[model samples]
Target: MSTALVLTHSVTAAEPSADGAPFGLAWGPITKVPRPFKAEHEANLTALFYPHGWDPANGPATAEVILVICRDEGLQQVVWVGLPMSGEALARTRRAIHAEGVRRYGEPGVGGTADSEVWPGGRALLASREAADGNRELVMTAVGPGYAACSETHHAETGHPAGTHMADLIGTGSP
Candidate 1:
């Protein structure tokens, strides 16, 4: 696999939720700070992707909402991408994502396949893998609006591993 450019930023505009959650709504633009992925980072990505199987919530034990935007070939492919806090959160976000899938692709199940007609401005596509392996990487690629890609890496040993690394490359921004 090619080494991807990892970027991160602290979202300061939004306040914590009413319940005092660690997550806040990210507005404006995410700062692009390029950094190499370390072993710890990989472990974290595993947890996020497969939280149910991970023994203890190693991180904050809080649900963080992330919006992943991707673009390719000068076209905007996806938007408002919300990652669930845990495996249970997956069920909740799944429905909403399915709805969006239908709206964009005219179909609900877009798993493990390349979808060229999913988004309005999206072109050239690839879907996430079906196998739930921690080491397995889930990614989608498109080329049109601009070169963009979203990658999710699971843990290799444990069945339940929070995604340690989730990265997106959209337009000129990196996160």
Candidate 2:
């Protein structure tokens, strides 16, 4: 994602900058999203998606894109799931995208697992990961004040294992 894309898609000039919120959705309130999105409630978390399709980003087409919001705490993360791929193509795409993330956010303060790269920031995080089935994804999570609490709540209610949610990386000193 280019800096131009980030600037053009951002919420409003008056709102606090959504440096970590992809597509320019800021980190507060469901109503503030500019695009019409459908919300799916799961435990205390809400997964919001644009049913009518969103404006395309510059790279490979996304099969799915979700913005996760913790109950009442507002937007928490943006997940962009690229279409499934296999073999060398998958590796190449993942590498290219991961490199782009590094260029945009600098070296990650933490995270260099075999299948993923994570960059932690003061208020959010940027990460790229390749799933076992070869699906690649980019995750941008808000890690500010209430994130830890939100992570705890989601884990408790959903029974998701630790580190299952990208936002769980917060407070792990891994960004």
Candidate 3:
């Protein structure tokens, strides 16, 4: 129903990446209006852990109105756009997002979680079922004050791994 959600679905499925630069360099300008959540993060109005995100200088997104791209160690993973609904509304917001993820992606992947502990935000390259006929779709993860979020698409195949990889990569480690 939400355009940004739809965009997230499409973008994650596409798995945008870069050879030697940030994807935003080609995603066009910061002129395009972002979704409410993205706009909030851009203004630092959300619980976003900054320095992980950046707005496009100028092409056209066709991906995310706002995104967090990390090119450290020359390891560029898929470019995914996420929104954090922290504070009092986090749980409810994550539920809505998780429902939406299932609606678009069918079922959760092998290591996916459809429970209350973790909330869906956005994901990609996911499996629908467990068998060989399983589907590779999208998913989302919730983020908050002590808890940071990462694209669950990465963990879908490996089950729930402990520790915070995003934190280590972003220097927000030790959380």
Candidate 4:
């Protein structure tokens, strides 16, 4: 099969805060060469998401991107990021992303899943499923304000803008 690289991002309403920091999670750009997938790729990606300990049923929200890196050796590697999203508006954003995936790639081979954790303030951590193909899928969820903090941390740690990193990860040049 011909390999494909996919990346998606969704914007949610920023949460109101007296602190006035831009509220929303942003994953740093990651880079990967395009590749096709087999069943193992999907399984591996799913396994990665579960370890973060999030459950989507609890009302946390997420945004994610899936990357499939195919090799001549017949193995595909999938990578993803889980960002927190919560509440009704964030949930709607997640659903919209799912719909977009279905429209573009047809039915995903796997359904979305999530794991949760607690962060500072009232915010919670989440990892929700995003998109999937025969080979890979992505899941993410995070609180609005908390998301922004995480994004900042990611940028500081990586030394490059998240959007730029994402572009490199998916080989899409730029977002």
Candidate 5:
């Protein structure tokens, strides 16, 4: 039941733009997303994605793009799950993802596993991690007052710290 918690610590990056959208999807409202997705909702989080699957240009073909929406706050995160692969594919995907992050958000911040890297941005936090089993994943979470508001609401309701859950919610580990 491991879940990937959203990074709540203070960041120097500017606040997320209200209109900013990652993965061609905007950052507010679930209705804005297209249909034909396998969907589920629990508490303040709603997870959905096209069952046919959408793959990032630089990502692996097996990857599933999961859209995470925070109730009331709209689309808060975009998750890309790359199914387990051989060493070479894993390494290549990791490098490509990291390079994309660097190009978009510049150098990453401290505190990343050898298999992971995180880039803080004015609009969101972009991160990528590779599981021990060679599952590569990339995550982007919206930042700013809207996110803080949602976090506070989530904490008040769950009695636990607010953060995104990957394993239990989306059925994966160390996303």
Candidate 6:
């Protein structure tokens, strides 16, 4: 994260200013002026590398998505970037993810899904599995939508209890 924050300005000037007061799309960092971000954007990067049984030390054998929520208007955020593997590529990622899910969460709870009413009016799908291997358990969320420019994936925990987290993205019950 850089100190520079990109913003849309209403000022219709060709350049900043002749007096060189200081003004443009870049505002550096907000050190004093209280311009609070009303909403929240979470990445859950703790499980970013591998929530699956795979060993992170073995290397980066996984994929991920960086959801860039651009606009936050309370109850919902309209614009965003959702990236994940898809089609033949998704199949490869899911195989590895599924193997870990079944190994850690045991069989049956591992599955996937595709939806028409995906976020932002498009189709999307995800295949993830969870196991009772540890406090973090092990879950893999690999998804991409027609609306998004790319595919994305996640390996994380149930956060609360083992069975509390539902794989709603998969349209299936938890393992």
Task: Write the residue-wise lDDT of candidate 4 on 1-175 in tens digits.
Answer: 1222222233222221233211222322224222322222221121112112222111222232232222211112222342433466446764565454344334444211223222334232122332343222333222233334443444565554333333443333442
lDDT of each: 0.25, 0.48, 0.28, 0.30, 0.49, 0.23
Model 6 Cα displacement at 159 (Å)?
Answer: 20
Cα lDDT tens digits, model 3, 1-175, are 0111211333223333332113322222223222333422211112212122233312232223323321111112222233332344434433454454465445554332332222133233221111123422122222221212222422343343212332232222322
**Inter-residue clash pairs, candidate 5:** 29-74
TM-scores of all predicted structures: 0.27, 0.59, 0.26, 0.27, 0.65, 0.24
List runs of model 2 lying over 4 Å from the truth: 1-18, 34-38, 55-60, 86-92, 109-113, 121-145, 156-175
Candidate 6, 67-140: lDDT as tens digits:
22211111111111112334564455445544533443344421333321121122111233221332111222
* 2 or 6, greater by TM-score: 2
Order the candidates by TM-score, highest first.
5, 2, 1, 4, 3, 6
Q: Give Cα distance to truth, residue 67, candidate 2, Å.
A: 0.9
**What are the runs in model 6 whose C-alpha is more than 4 Å off?**
1-82, 110-175
- Give the alpha carbon lDDT tens digit for every residue of 68-141 in model 5: 66788877665444454556865665566556556656787742334344566433344455556655444445
Ranking by lDDT: 5, 2, 4, 3, 1, 6
Task: Provide the lDDT at 31 for model 3.
Answer: 36
RMSD of each: 13.1, 7.8, 14.5, 15.9, 7.0, 20.0
Total clashes in model 2, counting residue pairs 3 or more apart in sequence or in different chains: 1
CA lDDT of 145 in candidate 4? 30
Of the two candidates 5 and 6, the one with more favorable TM-score, higher being better, is 5
**Per-residue lDDT of 51-96 in model 2, one digit per residue for the tens?**
2245422233444455566786787655554545666865665566
Model 6 poorest 10 in a row by lDDT:
72-81
160 Cα displacement, candidate 4 (Å): 34
